[model samples]
Target chain A: MAVNKRETIAKNIARYFHDGDFVNLGVGIPTLSANYIPEGTEIILHAESGFAGQDGAITPPWDVNDREACDRELNNPKWADKENGWKIGHKDICDASGNLAILSKGASCFDSVVSFMMARGGHLDATVLGGLQVDEEGNLANWMVPGKNIPGMGGAMDLVSGAKKVIVAMEHNAKDGAPKVLKKCVFPLTAINCVSVLVTDICIIEFIDGKMTVVAMAPGMTKEELQKRTEATIHFADKIDVMDIVEE
Target chain B: MNKVVDIRTAIDKIKSGDKVAVGGFGNVGGPMNLLYELEKHPEINHLTTISEDFQMSETPYNQGFTGLLLNGQIDEIVVSFFGHKKAQAKVDAGEVKLTLIPQGTLAERLRAAGAGLGGFYTPTGVGTVVEEGKETKVINGKKYLLELPLKANVALVKAYKADRMGNAVFAYTAQNFNTAMATAADIVILECEKLVENGEIVPDQVQLPGVFVDYVVHCEEVHY
Candidate 1:
């Protein structure tokens, strides 16, 4: 069995979604969970940019055939010249990353104030986010990388504080081969003891009573292999199940 | 009252060291025409901007705050998302001072200023670096950080349409920070894509009331 890390992680994460769940997917790998949502489940995706019921992201540089009209009217070379540049998808329909997104039929829009009100009011059920570092204490550190230019924490803190279940959907290791599932987070914390579950490339871990327990692992992967990639001492569930990766 | 004015006339209200709140997330809902006009004036320096995002670099047209940042027009930024690598370089080089606030906290702070509230306690940054140096109180056994209101000297807002009476209507999700920032500032200058007569926009359709608006400028929407 071929182990496609991101697809397997996304597929496994999708199993947690219940019907009629209002979920917020953060930028990066968490956004991929939208595509792998379990069949027959109705999940309303929330965009912090004042949109709820987001369907999916529009492919970049939305195809425009009228080059001359685009040039004369929009004056955006990206819109005019299709091959070289990117088109601004829609004026108002965008995800948190400023990429254009399509909305569901019953989607609603509001101002920034009302949007965060929903987030901070505990109206959301589940929030899946990308993480830089996650500790055994269920603390997540994802917003800022130390010594780099600080990109301000957008909405992670508020979501973590408000959401009933916070899921960290990311790769198990960083680009430098360091374990992101760490003994303790060296980076600044986005929130303390806020993460409920973690779906990584190699395993699905859940925080049960403040303990890191591996509930599932990727196909052909052993506990020793998973532990070798993880920095924290992990406990295993009684009957560990293989991650469900629906192949195309 | 006839609040409609030219773009330059509206842009002239911003002075040096003014606390300016701008609307927009990235390229959407930004007061581009007004900012474009402000970018021409090099004298409007040492300004503090309160916004949701940096209005990162867009292609074709150099719209949003990048022009102002490049010209050293902005000194301090109280924002939620300091976006773009180039904008971050400016911050790392000590060109602008950044006060990063969580997105919801930033929104609520502006709402507090607009609603005449003193401050709010939020559980967002309770155990994080964001709560450091701030007062913390335990309510119902939950720790919450005390975040204060943030008011601006001038607010530059964008609307899809506006009437002569200054009633503004926003389109779709374009009303991001524009609606909130409009209420939190002393002077609110609104730029609209279409300017109409007094009775053009219906009473119920108006997103921003005329009472809070000071000036209205008719400017075409710049396609990002």
Candidate 2:
């Protein structure tokens, strides 16, 4: 079976997770990494919006009678269902016990400043972020497009620059077939020399000693094929390995 | 000091052209009731808002700070992420002025203001557009940009619980910028979901002490 690029990239990035690692996942493809986190390995996921443990859909326990009130209060139709207690969509949610927790399963929260302090002070072990463009020097440009109305950079700059290891989880090519891995980024940069690993649908690229090295490629893809799709100069390692695709 | 006050009375403290630093990452820690009340006061205009981001979504009730921005109560917004489509359109049409600061810098600048510091240097935006027209100094061999402290006339913050004395605690990720904004403003108004006795909250769990809070308002419902 053919693997989806995003899931492939997310699974590839998930391999980097270990027990007790503090990881921050960026909005898009990187968020998927949380679902593929290896079992028995406890990794803490950090959201820039000030969450530390979990991400994605959270279902809070609610009395059947309180469903409408929850719906009316949360302003989300997802919570309007009478059968399923309450289903509100939030970046983070708390429990009835008054602890800052994620209902996605379980998680903890802290003051927002403490979260950013961990992000800016290099306390995070690794951060998985989607990128618009990554250069040979490991520079990233994922925040803004010149002259566009895209929301400004939130925590990408701090996460990329402060995390011990920065991983780029993105598709190999743009929708228009342009390579996102470029010789030079036309988009405005989020941070300079921050990316340590580039995980794409087709291949995995690593920056070792300031050089872009191809460490693994997707099944049925060749180094030449990935090189054709990438605009940056791609150098292969002494031995190339097939990327491990974990089936969910 | 007794810091708990009625929401209507707290809203009256804001004046026209006041620089208001609001706490929130979108609607997470946003003081929506205070912002909503401030919107009704048409006399309050030309305000400058400092925050981490604009509204997270376009939901009418969850508008939060974006409600003030849409009502033209805010003339300038200093934030890290300014990408709300409606607000961005206003910025493009020259309706609102935006000053984009990196998220961490935004947090640190507010923190510096509360800590009573002049400014601090950071290497986050050295060669990017963020460095334009900013003071750059090299300490050792690395270049750093001097980011001044951000202060405001009034700050609106949201917390999960507040005691009678105004010592506060915040909910999960909802505590985003509230604690920092609480100390960076001249008058800090906290909107809380739960109100307790002065000593009801344990000392260790108190995120922002009463010294920094000026007013505490009990919000009946969770706005965000």
Candidate 3:
């Protein structure tokens, strides 16, 4: 069975995430991956706003009645959520005598000190980032598009430098059809040899010894077919096989 | 007695019937040492505690509100997000009385109370049902206000560093409502991790001056 490029990319990512992993989903494509995350495994998502141990939908239907569903349970917990979530809301009300205490579940949030400490201290198991250019040496060029506009580096530097596993999700081609996976990135680099795996629409690219290695390709896409689309040098694994996307 | 005293003697100052305001937002700027000390002494009881989140590890609301509940110390708790299933379950079951406030309003109210203004107007809980029976007035005939005062009996603050004279500098979230709250309280207690020499803080960096301070509980380490 032949699978398309995007579908194959999603499966490869899902394969890496196991149950109970504390995954920080960055804003764009990384954030959408949560929908595809396998349930019952509890990949707790952390948002910057200040919710802790939260996994339910962001805001329930706006009706006053539906407001009660604000803190519904989702599976698993992030590293920070496990310790101080109770501190995120009213503790006394939670222990009130007659009323049932509803624990406010915020699957997304960050403690100012602890949140940054964890990111800086290598507590996050994995962080998925987007990239403007990913060079052969696994150098990540993200924060800016080289002199477009600098809107302060928002946690990208910390996530890039600190996360144990840095997974990147991006388009295989630029707007001009130029390949984003490059031999040498022209933009300012965020971190060197940081990206662990590249999940693109076309194939799975891994940074091996300062070069691009294609571990897996789309089902219908052949070796020659994959290289043609990419403008840069792409290393093809000798025993490369089609990804098991459809089966999953 | 309207006075600010040293925290080493804060236990003596904090009575059973005091409503204390703690500083911190989502556990960022809390005075954990003072609270921890208050817990350990077990000298005082029946406290009406106020603040954003009571983040004790054991029970979601364990160390806190329970002290208020079992002893009947807390008559009422004003907070937001207390309705998060676990805490709301307790509220609905009749164990405690929870007066829910919107998040931003809670902080501003604390600030207002600290600043000594009787009440400030806010458009937060207006019109859509949050404004239930509270006196809603029109300002400049524009239909723009609800006035709620900031009130607290005692304030507990945590800081990164403090001078022997009592100036404090906060870490990330600033959670300085506990600081503003200090102005409103008869008693102000500080649990500091680092106590520097007097005149250590430059005028620019000093957040809360010694004039508002009464007691200092010198300590090392935070409750992480």
Predicted structure with the largest TM-score when compared to the true one? 1
lDDT of 3 by residue, A91-186 (tens): 211111111122334333323334444554576778787778887777777765654433323445555656678888877888788878877787
Every prediction's TM-score for the first chain? Answer: 0.85, 0.80, 0.72
Global lDDT of model 1: 0.84
The runs of at least 3 residues in candidate 1 whose Cα sits more than 4 Å from the true structure, single-residue gaps closed, are: A57-89, A246-248, B58-62
Task: Give the DockQ (C-alpha) for candidate 3.
Answer: 0.02
> Model 2, range B22-112, lDDT digits (tens) per residue?
9876666778788888877767899988888775445555567666876888899888887567888888889989988888888888899
- Please write out the lDDT profile of model 1 over residues A1-248, one tens digit for every residue: 55677777777888889999998988867877777877788889888998887765422334333334434533455333455323333556667777655556577889999999888788999999988899999999999898876788998899899988999988899889989999999999999999999998888999987899999987788999999999999999999989876554
Give the top-scoring candidate (DockQ): 1
Model 3 chain B TM at: 0.82
CAPRI tier of model 2: medium
User: Each model's TM-score?
Assistant: 0.92, 0.88, 0.47
For model 1, state the Cα shift of residue A194 in Å: 0.3
Q: How accurate is candidate 3 locally (lDDT)?
A: 0.58
lDDT of 2 by residue, A148-216 (tens): 776777777777767899999878899999899999878888888888999998889999888899999
Clashing pairs in 1: none
- TM-score, chain A only, candidate 2, equals 0.80
For all candidates, state DockQ relative to the true structure: 0.75, 0.50, 0.02
Native contacts retained, all candidates in order: 0.83, 0.53, 0.00
What are the TM values for chain B, all candidates?
0.96, 0.95, 0.82
Which of 1 and 2 is ahead in lDDT? Answer: 1
